[model samples]
Target: MKKIALCAAALIAAIPAASFAQEADSTEATAPDGTRAFGIEPYIGIMGGYDSYDKRSEFGSPRGGKMNGALIQGVAGVNVPIGPAFVGVEGNVAKGFGDIDWEYGVKGRVGARAGESGMIYASGGYEWVNGKRAYSDQKDWIYGVGVEVGPKDIGLGGVTGNSGVRLRFEVDTYDFDSIRPMAGAVVHF
Candidate 1:
């Protein structure tokens, strides 16, 4: 009878410890940082760079020129994981150069986390630009490659859940004759 009582006591003591171990394992797996590994992140960003339009002659005079300007883009997108790489789609609106244009695209990137602070990624996307000009309205496809570096915890406040920055550089082209480099920064959510 004493042996049975002691066995019961040992089992009762082990129960709480076993429960604690399970709780601790779950906590480590479902932590906030771990949850950020993949998701949709809507962000607002600004880009400042040179823009060059194809030289077209209107009424026998050169009309397109290269200029420096600032652009504001709003992005809504999701990041998906494939093994060690990530793929995403972004729908964006860019307003600049006295006009507003709509761009929707898909981006593919290979990236890894940097400690507990941020991630570094190299990405490329295909974008379709549609808008009007002084002469007429047009649509074109632009392909580019770029790099982005930003915080791991991207949320309402910022990179650290308060305020953080994202940077990108891309060279986009509509045709062989029209290629331009663009760079910009975004205050991530």
Candidate 2:
């Protein structure tokens, strides 16, 4: 668990350096409207939802077990605008409560701008689950949809999209069997 957390931190720290590795192309610096086109985003959010084991007991009980609780997560990713659309890759670590202990995953998103400072996207990823049950093959593929409503660029003045605080909401399913919904704020760099 510590190793996974440390790796996530290291990956976040490395993105800035990766961005600097290449010489800045004029196009990479700003969008058509002259706002910053690319940057690193670090987000923290409250994750709440239910986890159920595939097999159920006779009384419809969790064959193995189930967890109903909220967890916290920290995610870091990079975003770049391509015309009216944006692309991003993110990695996250989560600590669960109740019957769940931990989860980690990486995801990719491709979406278009929603109005001026907002975005709507669809994402898919692979996640690993650590539950109280002694189960094998806890890793599975997940898919979900989400949206971000950022603070109006109008209020930020100066650069249109250099930075802003965004409200994010999303829901994902592990192996099409269990669901996890999350919401919170994201800080753009």
Candidate 3:
């Protein structure tokens, strides 16, 4: 029975790997059609945002009202390009003011390239929110959608050709319990 279970698990794993695999290509920086050659792109950025907790949120204030705060965060991630689409993993740490103490999370992103060097993506992740001692700490699943616009997309192609810098804006929900809006810039390499 153990051997049978092991074989079944192996098959389940191999099936997805087999479907995504493709014929190998030469190790060149850019493909013939002018897209990125098969490689990983790593990025880092800083953002500032606001979080508004639902009135019914577990992290309520001592006065029995909703809690809200401003936050600053640093993020890092790596993306694997697959043709015009890509998949990535990202992590972030944030410091909060007002009723919040700290927030941190890790998420997975998937999206497609848009308009020269821009991207539109969706992300889902797990987050931990720490509140001031007067409030409670909570952890939940978060979901977001965001866009990144590169120099070329924003009409700076002549001066900053492929500079690997982008402007990002996103909105996220904290377990359908809070609203978060953030904007920032990211540099990729």
For all candidates in order, the CA lDDT equals 0.46, 0.63, 0.81
Each candidate structure's TM-score, on Cα atoms with residue i matched to residue i, is 0.50, 0.66, 0.81
- Cα RMSD (angstroms) for every candidate in the order listed: 17.9, 9.0, 6.7
Q: What's the C-alpha lDDT at position 100 in model 2?
A: 65
Model 3, residue 13: distance off in Å is 17
- Candidate 3 at 60: error in angstroms? 2.4
Model 1 ranges off by over 4 Å: 1-44, 56-70, 98-134, 151-165, 186-189
Which residue runs does candidate 3 get wrong by more than 4 Å?
1-33
lDDT of 1 by residue, 12-125 (tens): 445534544555534232222344433554555666554455554220113444322345555555545322234455555556454324434554443433433344444444
RMSD score of candidate 1 (Å): 17.9
Candidate 2 residue-wise lDDT, 1-189, digit = tens? 435533654564455445544536444654434466654444544444444444431112335554444678777787766544567888888877765688889987766566667777767678877765444336767676788876663355354454567778888776556667888777766
Model 1, residue 12: displacement in angstroms?
Answer: 56
Off by over 4 Å in 2: 1-65, 133-137, 153-163
By TM-score, the better pick of 2 and 3 is: 3
Which consecutive 10 residues in model 2 have the weakest lDDT in total?
53-62
In the range 53-130, model 3's lDDT, one tens digit per residue, is 988878766577887899999999998876556678999999999888999999888776778888887787889999
